[model samples]
Target: MNLFRLDASILPTTSTSAEIADTVEAEWAAAHPGATVTRRHLGTDPLPADAWALAATGGFAPEQDRTEAQREALGLATELAGELERADAVVLAVPLYNYGVSQHFKTWADLVIAAAGPTASLLKDTPTVLVTTLGGGYGPGTPREGWDHSTPYMERILRDAWQADLTVIKRELTLAGTNPAMAALRDLADEQHLRALTAARTAGRALAG
Candidate 1:
């Protein structure tokens, strides 16, 4: 089995999303033993911001008439799409930044669409897990209840657009322990953290099984 793991955490060491993804990956690793795990760290090595535009425009141009840059961009787009097609499973650890998906993830998604076409289900029926975390609460009645604009968009892409057999794991209020203003929420944050961790292990086992 081959697993494709994508991480968009700028702060890898302290990323709550990554912490959960690690558990899922660990279980997959243990189950597969010698199976392959392809990894991409978009935060540290972001894709060229212009690649998606180049790839999209290049598609309209004849192959022989495509510019060198266009050719390279298309190649990268193809590779990104191919990764999804080749994987038996997928893990995407994405966090909310400014209440939306980060640029790294946006670029990656654009590239994939550039290669696979907007309607293509590259991960059709593939078991995929998306781990997303937020620093503040966004549940009903919370001040930011509707402010979270990341998770739903990704759900549209991964579950609806990509057609993956997707599972989502989420955690919020991650800053309660460190942010002075959120001190009152520390206890609740702790509870949420443990629940997220437990959910991670369960998701991992399900992925492996």
Candidate 2:
């Protein structure tokens, strides 16, 4: 089996989403000792910003008439799609930044979609796990309820567009103790983190089976 893990947190080591994903990956590794694991650090090595645009427009031109930049974009899209096609399962650790989606992730997604083209449905049915972290509470009943715009976009793209068999694990209130405004919610944050980590491990084991 092969696992393709994509980490989109700029703070690599200190990222809660990545840490939780580590738990899931650990369980996956334990279940499949010899399984191959591919890692893509989108935060540190984001795809070219212009790649998507070049790809989108290049499709209308003949390959031989494409500019060098367009050729590179098409090549990148092909590579990105190939990674997903090769993986038995996919794990994505993406964090909400400034109440918005990560541009790096969006670029990757765009490239993949471009590569898939008319046969996009071919990307369906794969088991995919998405781990997301929010600095503040955004769930129902919270003061900022309905304020999360990242999760819904991710779900629409991954589950609705790609049609992957998706499983999402979220950890909210991450800045409770660190941020003065949320100091009183420290305990809730800790509890949420623990639950999220436990769920991540459980999901990994189930996927391995």
Candidate 3:
């Protein structure tokens, strides 16, 4: 088994989302001993700027007319697409910024979803786990609930574009000034997220067997 971990937190080493992602990787490694794990850090090591243009164009511009920049961009996009195609399971550690996923994660999504022909579904039916860290909770009836777009958007994109079986585990209310009770609730939520990942792994193994 192989698990691909994408760390989308913009913060250096201090990001809570990155911490959660590390924990998820640890848990996954524990559950599947000897399994291969690949990590991509998008915060500091962003894909080349031209990668987006290549993804949008579906390929490199005409070779003879292609500028050096365009060629570099196409190369980056092809590399990213290759990584996405090879993963068996994907784990994304996404931090909610202004109620949306980081722009880096979105860019990766755009490239991977741009594959051609039958390879377009290379990510289809793959198991995906999303860990989102937010400043405030977004469950039903919570204040600012309507602004909650991370999980729903991810679900739709994974299902519609990649055909992934998506599972989301959110840790919210990490900001200061929240009531102690609410903080505890958020911790509980994180724990539950771990449990959910365990279950998902078991199910995936069973299906493979």
Select the stronger candidate by TM-score from 1 and 3: 1
lDDT (tens digit, per residue) of candidate 2 on 28-117: 899889889999999999888899999988877998899999888999999988888888888999999888789899999889888788
- Per-residue lDDT of candidate 1, residues 12-126 (tens digit): 8888899989989998898899999999999888999999999999988999999999999999999999999999999999999999998999999999999999999999999
Of the candidates shown, which would achieve the greatest lDDT relative to the real structure? 1
How does each model score on lDDT?
A: 0.94, 0.89, 0.69
lDDT of 2 at 75: 91
Of 2 and 3, the candidate ranking higher by lDDT = 2
Candidate 1 lDDT score at position 71: 99
- Runs of candidate 2 exceeding 4 Å displacement: none
Winner on lDDT between 1 and 3 is 1
RMSD for each model, in Å, please? 0.8, 1.2, 3.9
List clash counts for every candidate, in order: 0, 0, 0
